[model samples]
Target chain A: MSIYLDNGATSYPKPESVYVSIAEYMRNNGASPGRGNYSRAMEADRLVYMTRKALCKLLCVPRPGQIIFTCNATESINMALKGYLKPGDRVLTTSYEHNAVARPLKMLETDREIKIGLIPSTPDGVSDMEWYQQELSKGVRLVVVAHGSNVIGCVTPLDEIVSAAHRHNTPVLVDAAQTAGVYPVDVTSVPVDMLAFTGHKGLLGPTGTGGLYIREGLELSTLKEGGTGGMSLSPFQPSDPPDRYEAGTMNIFGIAGLNAAVQFLLDTGVEVIREHEIELAQFLMDGLDTVPGVTYYGPSSAKDRLGLVSFNLEGQDPNKVAIKLDRDYEIMVRAGIHCAPQAHHLLGTAPGGALRVSLGYFNQREDIERLIDALREITYS
Target chain B: MFLQSINVLDVDLCVQQPDKFVAHTRASADLREIMPYLNSMFRTSTYNHDAGSIKFTNDKIEYTIIGDKINIAKFINRTELHELLDWLKDLVNDTYDSRSEIIPMYVCRKPVPVLFIYNLLPKTNCQQCGEKSCMVFAAQLNKLEIDIEACPILSEPEYTANRRRLEGAFGAFS
Candidate 1:
């Protein structure tokens, strides 16, 4: 039987409820929300609202209306960046961000004449808070940081970072793509200005579903505006938010799946899932240590990092090792940069990336054991 | 658990107010058993024991429950309608749960007759309430089909006593 391990990119074999909800919505309720006041359309409308409500409960957001739906975390990051940043604004970010945050800020740097500064971090991925405090004092309009690095798998010290930025009267936007579903992302406690997340990763929802939570009283420009299912008479878009940010027909299908996924997360507490992932990540990391010619990246302990780990083999291309594990052992894992060049640059693996085996809520010790066995065999081969 | 869902049967543009919407929905339960309880809980409710019907207003939206059907009018949009439905469903379920504790009112609040209302009206076919004529408005008002506030002329100093009489007969004020 083939084993799926590439959960960091997109979770596989989603919770059965997620699949069932999508099919049920598509087969039974195919009507568009806000298109008409018909029963079915109203059902779709409630379905969308319930999705937002579920996400709010899952993410610990106080209001459902503050969460704006997008196609993915990339769109969320783009929206948060493009809408909030004005011309010649200064943005401070982590060195370990995925391209979702990097590319948009780069585009803004060119188009809007904004400036970007990377927070100084230690070799293992912890941010230099002293340097960060000095930078915050120097004044930045916004601070964007990844809650967890997709490349190295280290969980950033968000409390320290967010507290420092807010002290400086600067708002912070978090790209929580990797940490949202697995970690306790309580906006109530931490009070992040904006938090962007994806549905298909730890959230265990279908692709094309994600959202951004904008704190109350914080309004951002619309990334794109069209039919928002309401207020058609006004030629100009409504001043109220999520409608202000969310325009055009939403992906109700994906949202239905996401609703179920978020409900699953709420039912099965993220704390329980966090404990499980930590155990699995530790097992995988500890197992890799036994195999000669294998070297892993990120923190030594699993508790300090995410459920994913990246590593390399001596004198072997990561792509071929990934392919061999897939073809010969029926094991699936991702290889290469994983689309965060800056993270790879930090790890001194700029061009060539490492083998990444990310765990899921459903992953077991047997799966990691089998992966270890495959790697031990490949070490000699 | 007593009221699980609301099945919306028909949705139409509210005639009294064109910009808003009206929905004809059937609750999972007949809600006949809970009407008295609802009548007890809602101060604004007008319960008619003889007709097995109850009408109430919440957040300026009118709800008339007869048998299993609940007609809701003057809602802004589908989202608000759904929220109202959920609110109503919760209210029904909550009232059903504590039903034994609530005292049921078996009395019918009197419905003002149509001609009586027509006599108080300016008797002009004002059509101010978007109705065709005063008689139609009075008939609609008698059925609780439209709010008494729909008639602007009724507010004038010429009809203060009539307006008070109408409000008293309806047991209501917008």
Candidate 2:
């Protein structure tokens, strides 16, 4: 079988339960939730509700209604950005943000006259706390950051960032797109103002599924307004939590798959998954040490990062390396800027991106061995 | 209309289909003028004006344009390659000849952007069209995978202007 290692973009070979649940939902109850009173519709609503609750539990969120289902983390980030910021709002973000956060912020910079200050980050992908504090002291309205860098797989110190923002009375928005399902994120203890997540990556759900969790009493203006299967005659958007934010029909099919994936995570345990992934990543890194002319990015230790490694062979384009990996070794990996131009710029991997091999719970030690073996061959051959 | 040269610069394994090949070709001629018309004619064609590229499938062979180069993917053998080149030549010439009759569309006529299409649609997000949301329905419409008439709200008199725009944009593809 081919080795699938591009889990950062989207996890492949999802748990059997996720696939089975999606098919069963499509076949048995494909009705739109909250739109009808029929049995199938109610079942759809129940499934969606269960999925929300599972997400809340997984993220340590207090309320299920606070979680709004979105198409993907990009949509969730857009909603958070557009909904929260007003004209002339000063925002502080890190250098390691994905395009999801950067593009929306850039648009708001023009449309709302918001000022954005990017906190300089270290080469290891950690936010420079001194610079962040200096920026925060200058009185910013909001602070947004990515919990993990998708390019280098480095996990930022969210606790410090959140506390720093909270001390300044500025709310923090955490883009947990890379860390949500792979790492243990306790929002209850962290006290982030908002957290956005995607289900397709480490969560092992299908594409077109993701969510945003808003903290209690933090009101964001609705980004979209439509029928929420309630207050149809009111001619105004609902004033409730989820209904107010979720203005469109939910993706019940994707939610069904996500629910099963979350259930699998709960059963298998997040720590267990994290350990397995870290082990694989450590193995890959250790093996890479023996391979000459191969330079890797991210934290030196696997303990400081997620389950992925970004590297490039000497004088080889990342795309070419990835293509060779796929064609010759049947190993799939992601190349290019990975939608994080700022991070690439910070890492000095710009103009040519690095090849990324992201690990998952499903990955084994042999996969890393095969990848290292192939890289050694490529480097010498 | 004869070409000076068509050189296969590279052959890479196809991502979607592993067994198939993606041959990148460097052509001597600029193929921009015929792109929009081809987008209009082919149901599978998706053109991005901003990117100045068109992606389409003809005779089960996927062709993607980037500047003057073409990446013909998912082809089996030399026969398919010859057939695709001849077909492309004929299409380019035919489109050039009938330029007056065809409106050179810059955006994708087959699969228009869902958000752009959604703006013209009734923002109801009603599931009457058997789609979860009008956005999803718009995506389906752009792919020419679903009928615009499937949406019952579009038939209403209030949405006549929007329907007209949608029809003007996608009706020919249908």
In terms of docking quality, model 2 is incorrect
Clashes of 2: 1
Q: What TM-scores result for chain A when each predicted structure is judged separately against the true chain A?
A: 0.99, 0.99
lDDT of 1 by residue, A1-381 (tens): 899999999998899999999999999999887787677887887788888888888888886678889999999999999989999999999888999999999999999999999988765798888888998898899999999998888998778888999999999999999999998898988999999999999999999999999999888888997887655766877666677777888899999999999999999999999999999999999999998988899899999999999999998899999999999999999999888988888888778789999999999999999999999999987
Clash-forming residue pairs, model 1 = none
Per-residue lDDT of A1-381 in model 2, one digit per residue for the tens? 799999999998899999999999999878997776465765576578778888888999987778889999999999999999999999998887899999999999999999999887787886778888988888999999899999878897888998988898999999999898889999999899999999999888999999999998999999999987654656878666777888888888999999999999988989999988878888999998999988888898898899988888888888998999999999999999999998889888997989999998888998888989999999888
Candidate 2 off by > 4 Å: B1-174
Least accurate 10 contiguous residues by lDDT in model 2 chain A? A37-46
- TM-score for each model: 0.80, 0.68
Question: Candidate 1 lDDT, tens digit per residue, B1-174?
Answer: 898898777677788986677889888888888898888766567888768899988778999999889999997655567668878999999888898898877765555789999999998897889999999999988767688789999889989999999888776422
- Per-model RMSD to reference: 7.4, 24.1
Candidate 1 docking class:
incorrect
Q: How many residue pairs clash in each candidate?
A: 0, 1
Best by lDDT: 1
Model 1 / residue A25 / CA error / Å: 3.3
